[model samples]
Target: MDIKKHKIINRYYHKNCISCKSWLPATEESFYSVKKNKDGLHSYCKACVLKKAKESMLKNYDKQLERMRERNLLPGMKKAKKKYNSSLKKKKTQQIWQEKNKLKLKNYRLQRDAHKKHNITDVQWQKCKDYFNNKCAYCGLKIEDHKILFKGTYIQ
Candidate 1:
């Protein structure tokens, strides 16, 4: 393969590694390299170029973070977080109230029915009637006038 293709970017003079100073052929796949210049200085290998670029970038980022801290960005951020949490708490409370009220209404209806002293399950009623052949267990009462001295069994 032609090493020259790597020089598609303008090639400076001889290129070398930044850390070890070992010479390397100019190549495009390199992570960092000197942009071509009229001056005859050899281009740096990708590694040295990358180190310089990263150092500058990190320095700028640190400056930006310092500026933000000075401007009190932290307090504004906390207030926004607090407001979001409060809204979530309110929504949860409303949802819980709705669920509890629904269950309470169901139990109220069941209690009302139980208070009326209705004793027999539909199954029990049919069994009692059939076993007695339509005669009341106690008084031998027939259908339409069926009444027994004993109470219907309702476990609850």
Candidate 2:
């Protein structure tokens, strides 16, 4: 209706984006809020800001990765490293225990083999061990001595 009223309405309701040079509604949805700006809205529209940010991230992707690695802030890197270290420690401990209990492990394997192959129960295997005084039948070597002599070897 009135020219001054129309001008005032357009001035307050619409804004031109500095980056895109497009007119958008002067609202929080169209532009980010900026306390420093007189109109309390960013100069660039939301789309322009997002585009610039994406371009910047793509351009500096490697730099960001290096920075994150340096700061130990890369996602999953720390977790993976920790998991690997713990697993390595666990493996080392298991190897040490296996080394210390070599005789026990050999006896367990013999019993398991006897049960699976000959259908011998644990009590029968124990009786057999007692009959031979826990010595190898062919070699006449004690279980402890056999374990040391034939370390890492599987006997049937």
Best by lDDT: 2
Candidate 1: minimum summed lDDT over ten consecutive residues — where? 147-156
Candidate 1 — which residues are off by over 4 angstroms? 1-14, 31-42, 66-156
Each candidate structure's TM-score, on Cα atoms with residue i matched to residue i, is 0.25, 0.42
lDDT of 1: 0.53
Alpha-carbon local distance difference test for all models: 0.53, 0.71
Write model 2 residue lDDT over 78-104, tens digit each, in one string.
Answer: 776687668878779867877999999
RMSD of 1: 33.8
For model 1, how does the per-residue alpha-carbon lDDT over 37-67 read when each residue is reduced to its tens digit?
4322335655566556556544465564456
Pick out the ten consecutive residues of candidate 2 with the lowest summed lDDT.
Answer: 1-10
Residue 54 displacement in candidate 2 (angstroms): 0.5
lDDT score for residue 53 of model 2: 66
